[model samples]
Target chain A: MSRVLMKGNEAMALAAIKGGCDAFFGYPITPQNEIPEYLSEHMAKEDRVFVQAESEVAAINMVYGAGGAGARVLTSSSSPGIALKQEGISYLAGSEVPCVIINVMRGGPGLGGIQPSQADYNQITRGGGNGDYHLLSYAPENLQEAVDLIKQSFDKADAYRNPVMIAVDGLLGQMMEPVDLERTPDSKQRERKEWATDGDAGRRGKANTIVSLHLDPNKLEEHNLALKEKYDRMVENEQRYERLETEDAELVFIAYGSTARIARSAVESLREEGYKVGMIRPITLWPFPENAFKKLPDTVHTLLTLEMSLGQMHQDVKIVNQGRYHLDLYARTGGVVPEPEEFIEKAKAILKKEDAA
Target chain B: MNSDTVYRPKQGLTDREFHYCPGCTHGIIHKLVGEVLTEQGLIGEAIGVASVGCSVLNYVYFDCDMQQAAHGRAPAVATGIKRVRENHAVFTYQGDGDLASIGLAEAVHAAHRGENITVIFVNNAIYGMTGGQMAPTTLIGQKTTTSPFGREKEGTGEPLRVSELLATVPGAAYLERVSVHDPKHVRKAKKALEKAFDTQMKGKGFSLVEFISTCPVNWGIQPRESLDWAVENMIPYYPLGVFKDPEKEEEDD
Candidate 1:
């Protein structure tokens, strides 16, 4: 495993390659352009499939086809582009196709700036596409964790027969960090997908068909329930997060992705000043790691959610906190990232407001 | 069961009833596809990508492996399926609205890339599923739900001649437009399907065959009249001929 400094987008592209991804189809979008550029250069040399699709809509549709045909495929886009991909993403979810998708999120409700933002938290984690479906969502806090999660996401997609989304802030994509390019897991090489359309050569008389259109209401509900059961299994088996200094701490911080990384520096300073501060950094945002919130020590009295969005993930935090602790939100938006000192000020202000009330 | 099968339905087509509206010619095209695949010995390996519109559930009808693509995205889906499983014969069955409208770019690009696949595009002149509406290939002056006052040339543009449009792409190896109105034309349509699949098997490049189809229910005409309408209206406007066939050209050379 060679250690090399790499941008998060390039690291993600290499991580997918090492993880045995068969194809990469995507369009060039800001903050994630490096992913397609890197894949284009290496994938062509490696003789793998790399297509810069005509549009995000086309790219995701290509992903749906490759994924349906039982090939490991990946696509990446920024927030606005990801919005364009939602319809295809929904189709993939509806068809139960396994694939990996990345959204190096930039600021957006519409045509927002091309900078790091957590604004897409709701969009990615909630399955931006139509229908009742969910993506195996991961929000890694650093470049290393992003690489690890991206490599594992392909396996998760294949295992669960669903799309997996790695929603990282644009900063993590542009930031350089040392990564081990050889960390590909050989054990996770998938078997032949029986449900995939990989040709019926020597298989059986009936061809494997992948379709999502359940015209009858009864059958549609049955399909939705089956999908819900699969998601429930993920909730039990796949929830992951990191907890820091929760033991005997009165104030706890809940954050993820880039915000969680920034929260670490703020938590350190608060602890050095003799304050009982802790952190809960969620790795899996869809499952929300509610168990981690449930396992918090009794010393935690107030929970503060720090995010780069307009407090989108804060809603999930509220759901998990369940009124046991005072929940508050400290957020920035439209590509503005909060500094460590700024977070400290916000945390102090929250705790101070609680003290007065 | 037949000990020595002679007249059993083609193994390429499944036993499921087609969901096409009564008098629609999608069933004929589907049967032609099945016959062609069986004759080419590609029944077991052909992967069909079904587009949205009326034929969305073609995944259930084709005995081969099938995928249902989103509206207008079947060409892109077929490209994906073909790239990953190169040995399999991949084809897309799409309707006029699905092909000439929202999915135009995918069709053009796939043909340009010379993707080894077959496209059985059925131009029935109107959207059948969502009720009769103005399709991109809808004839000017055709009245529908969207164009209740009749589709005017100043507003909706001319009926798209899709076969002619795709023939211009450099990577397309074979392109043809046929009709399925009568027994004679039905036989010819099946032959065109065989040639299209054969083109893919030869690793020739992109191949497409547009069928001048009929939509009786949506066209406000009887099944018999729809056949006459195709001959009188669609055939004249859309025409019926080989727009481009490199294999035929090479033979002439």
Candidate 2:
């Protein structure tokens, strides 16, 4: 497949089509509007479903409707918009509906700036929606990876019978990069959803009801435990990360999405200056790629975690670290994208402080 | 057991008993919908969206593909289903609290988009499922748990006329306000439901049938008295009539 230059949001949109997405329901939000805009025309041309919903809340519920009706569905929004979608997301999770949601990260506590930020690390990985549920969340650094993951996510969602989220920063959504949009099938085989409520057509013996309400306490407990088992399977089988030169290194850097690209640059410059630094890029945020920490050589003593927010991902790192390695955090919150040199300076200062201690 | 059966239960409903309170009009309304779908031979081809009010558990009773939606979100969910399954019949069962109060945007926008679906709006003038709280469709002088001092039009505003409000939306192809106070009116309400479903089947656009229902327990009245109360108090404020009919307009023209 030839690589074509495309915007990050648009590529993900086209990738959804190539991934056998039968419907798209979304509301327009900054840095992610192109996804809906592109799909509105293309989905029509492809004879698929496309609805520009009234709000993010309605869009996600529409996703619940489409997915429950046995259509491969997708929805996209930014930070505050994603916040609005939490109610429907909880419903989708409780109902065990399959769908994909893309959150183009932006600054927020409430209506914060539209600039790129990883402030939603907790919102995506943590249960933003009320429930004991987790989304199979991925954070990709570049257009190609975003397209591939977004495409595969449909099948992953269907396979797990759960929602999958792709978390990309506003910079990635607005940036242009060359991407190969060819459909690459994942090995996970998706089965036919017999639980879908797509009208009987006289074939079904009974009506299929898509629901989340369990009135009985013991029944609700059973449903929660069933969901927990599915999440545990995701943890065991779906941990993914890219290890860059961790062997025989003194320091390791942890980052993901757009910040991971900057961290890679910082690591390369530091190695040239004889700092013996490596990096670990986590592709799966929910699974947290704790296995990456186990791969670090005994020589690696300090691990630095970087983000565009105030140490949200740092919480996960600390939980997984268990004080095995000295942990340090460097964050530039409120939509500030730090430069590679800044990481270099931060890393040097951290190493100097560690050496002094 | 098979030969002399003169009257059979509606096939569109399941054997599962409804959880609605005695004399609640939800059961009567459910029977109307079931009869309409079964009579139209759409039970196999219909999908019902149950809302988060008294009708939340209608998914169990409605013998068709069903999805339970969050509070005030059944319209949005129904839109998603209809958009995906265009050839199939899709409808939402919502109460006044679900449709008028919280889900106002979802309901209005679904109509504004002219989504090919049906809405069964039940206006009982009070919230029944939440122990008789004041609803958006509550009568001006009616008292409830939330409006203990009788609903004052100054602070809470008057009751919402959902059928009239939706009639103003250009996308709505059919809008009717019907009451189920008596046997004669129950027949008319069922006819309204049939027409609403017919509008969807004909691929017209958004259609809604708003039913003036009785909540005996919530209203602090006897079951039969609640019907009379609805006729006397509710019907005067929410006058029954056809609010919009695009196809009827065409015929008149």
Candidate 3:
């Protein structure tokens, strides 16, 4: 495969085109502006549609319209832009339209900062929109993963008839890493005309209505129930997590996205210092690896959960643990990323406390 | 003569019935939109965005891909649907309250950006869905639930002329205002709807056709009398005409 050093955001934009995405609709926001800018230049070459919407709301709605027409479409933004798109995302989720939404997350809690942060774990996993719907969220750690995840997002969205989000922190968007452009998946095999609104010629007898409305209470209930069943199936099939040195470990370090990379470094240092510390990184935030935590033995006395936010995923870790063991949460917010040395120090203190107790 | 079958409403709408009050113009507008979709053979390839108002249940009435947006957010949602599915005809059926009030920003931006979609703005001068309230297009000195002592130009300000305001936006391709008070007006309004949809199909960008409708129950008048009042009072404040034609402007440009 031809290797090329590329920024994560640029890789994602190229991957979307390689994945046969027909349109790109987005508004400019920091750390993710490269995505739209790249599409503006490259989409015309591929005869694809690229629209720089007046606002985030308009961009996301354009994605919804394009997705409804059965075209592989995408939209990208940072925290503030993602906030503006929440209503549109909710409607897209409710309508069961397939599309890709890239949130190269920045510091937030209302215009906090533009630095990279994984503070949107709760927002992305537990429905950022207004309805009782779940979007398939993929957390990418590097430029390669960013490209691969965007390519896979289309298939996952179409397979489930739902919106798929590639939640990358601003670090992944800005960081340059070597990516194999030759290994990009070709999505030409996917038949779009079967369900897309690409003119009505071959299928004359059947009338297709792509609506989410059911006036009859019973029919609406049935529709919601079917969606729930689909979600349950996804929970069973799509739960993914990475384990590093879980075997013969006293403590397990839990993290994801960029924080997980930092955790890996800390784990490596702690192992060199003769501490039995391992790490568990969740790739899919939704349909979270609830079983992974349960698989750990009673010997694993302490679980350290690290994130860029204040203990958002720690709540899920505690819920999964069900009070079998206590969990320690460490976080740094407002665009500050915790250093690996700080995590190592924390791990050392927890181990000393265990020994003292 | 086979007159009985001739006047029956098209089969696109189900017989489950609507919650709109007797003589409400929503049913008539719904019938008109459905008929256009049927006549153009665009039913399967059309997606309708329903706005929050008396006609929020437009999803139930229109036999096509229907989506409901928050208040006046239908244009934004329709923009999304149209961009992704370029071949599908996308339209937003919105009320004056939904369009002129909270969703004003979305409407203006969509028009300014020239999104290739159709907007069917139903201006009844009052918020019929959320009880009678002062709407953006409410006539000055016209009474409603909010303006109990009659709309005061000094207090509530003047009614908004949506077509005129939109006509000023450079991206708008076609902007027309029509009423549905009489049979003649109804025919003309249908033609306007067709032209707006045609503009989108030709990829000519944004097109909006505002239908000055009636809310008889909220206005405290009979359906026929409400029509007369709308023609007399509303038409003067919000005149009926094509405010902007992109083709004509292009020749001038």
Candidate 4:
């Protein structure tokens, strides 16, 4: 009921416990190490399971194993570590295993840096692993939002029977903020997983096999289509975004995660200066809040995307824009955290270009 | 009264026929595991992790709950299952290629962590599912698809002795290398499997039984000839015996 100042990584870890996470399997990685470090002590105190796996591959596979056994499991890592987890993630998606993964992202094409960067936007939203798959991904802009989303991700993962990913930049991971852990999204009642391979399924007369392999081409196609149907449901029901001061705005800054916080500040600054600037912050990056763009007023013509990566989210904006609006992008790479002033400058240049044209 | 039945289909194994190659020893090994679980009355509480290989579909063959893990990741998967389902008899049925090659880290670390689980490692010395490629346990001078002329000791290392390697780990409660080339050794292999499972049920840490198995089709030999080949070649190198037995050591002490 009371608020406490907590580190971002630690808050997410505590939120997982509140969300009824039964097990955590992860290997150490930079900027996100606190998640495991905190859980190692607290998970045991709660009489839950905690395993420090040998590598990211082992950790995620462990998650697959636990989830296949119908346990609420979680794993956290940085960008490169998440890249290592793609193989297991693919298997989890293919098998329809429910678990939550947190990527307190840092820069990377390959171990680029250990500072805050949204470079994993594409990796988390798109299928980082092979084949056609998608995670219900969230990119929260603040510590409180990150905590709430991390708590709700478990139920959402169970509801969809798929992995849910929370992608936050390293800044959110390392920053400290006051948060009320008691506040959580409404918990969806989870049906018992009768298909889980926890021995009980066998004892009850119908043994279960949690597998992704469908050797027959026809069967594999059927499975893929079934998964596509689930994903389509997510797109219809789960698109989430926050619109800020966009009623009569002509220019909108599109961003998410830490970048969105910066864009919000820029929007405020431009509004104070008598410029009609607004922002659209996407909370769910996978079923990316395309509805937010559709609701933009007729006066809005230009959409500028700001990102910690070099235009990863910008690609999504372009797709949803469909030539409906003038699009532009401003980005910083390799762990560079751009300031609000930069977004303001970019917005001004974009509007000036539109006026000139 | 009717004469007592000498043998029956194991309740632990499902009705599905094994998909292993005709000459492959995976069937014999699978039977041993199935019988072990059934005999110990652990079938109802057992959870098996099936690894990728010719035995990838062992999930269909095992009547108990099963999880098919990524190639070589069965050990890690079993660890995850056992940690959560502590009362369940969790085990991984992995081939030499799956346990000794890409999944070596997961296998060794699982043992090192003293996870209370059993691993049924089938060391056939060649990759069977992928058409006779050289495996980590492929012996020197052996010819495989990948080692066309023969396996060179310099180009590729000597066969990995997984039982001996795991025996060195302090957490391993039981480690044994057995073969099923003959009826006597087949019984011995099943006994080793029983002991490994018993260790897990008793809450003792990691246990593994390595079967020096044969892949006849991959070896380009008759099924009958392959048994003799395994006895003559593999036993000398992989040496059948209990490599580590913490329970026996305690009794000796």
Listed per prediction, chain B TM-scores read 0.95, 0.95, 0.94, 0.96
Candidate 1: residue B193 Cα off by (Å):
1.5
For model 2, residues B1-253, the per-residue Cα lDDT tens digits are 2879755576689999988887788988998899899898898989999999888999999899999999999999999999988989899999999999999999999999999999999999888888999998998888899999999999899888898888889899999999887778888998898899889999999999999888999899899898889888988899998999977878988
Q: Each candidate: what lDDT? A: 0.88, 0.92, 0.83, 0.91
lDDT of 3 by residue, B31-101 (tens): 88888877777776677888888888777677766666766777877776676567778889999999999
* Tens digit of per-residue lDDT, candidate 4, span B161-187: 998899888889999999888789888
- Tens-place lDDT digits, model 2, residues A1-357: 789999989998998888889999999999799999999999999999999999999999999999999989999999999999999999999999999999999998999999999999999998798989999999998999999998799988988999999999999999999998874763243566799999864578878999999999999999999999999999999999999989988889999999999999999999999887899999999989999888678888888999999999999999999989989999998889999999999889877876788
TM-score of chain A of each: 0.97, 0.97, 0.96, 0.98
Superior by lDDT: candidate 1 or candidate 3: 1
Docking verdict class for candidate 2: high
Model 3 lDDT per residue over A112-226, tens place: 7999888888888888887578888888767777787777788889999899888989988998889986565756568754554343422543334455556698988888888
TM-score of 2: 0.97
**Ranked candidates (DockQ, high to low):** 2, 4, 1, 3
lDDT of 4 by residue, A1-357 (tens): 779999999999999988889999999999999999999999999999999999999999999999999999999999999999999999999999999999999988897899999989889988999999999999999998988898899999998999999999899999999998878754554676887998885448888999999999999999999999999999999999999989999998898999999888889889999889988999999999999988789889889898998998999999999999888899998999999999888888878887898
- Calculate DockQ per candidate and list them: 0.71, 0.83, 0.44, 0.82
- The list of candidate 3 runs beyond 4 A from truth reads A182-184, A193-206, A211-221, B1-19, B35-45, B250-253
Q: On a 0 to 100 scale, what is the lDDT of residue A333 in model 3?
A: 80
Tell me the TM-score of each prediction against the true structure.
0.96, 0.97, 0.92, 0.98
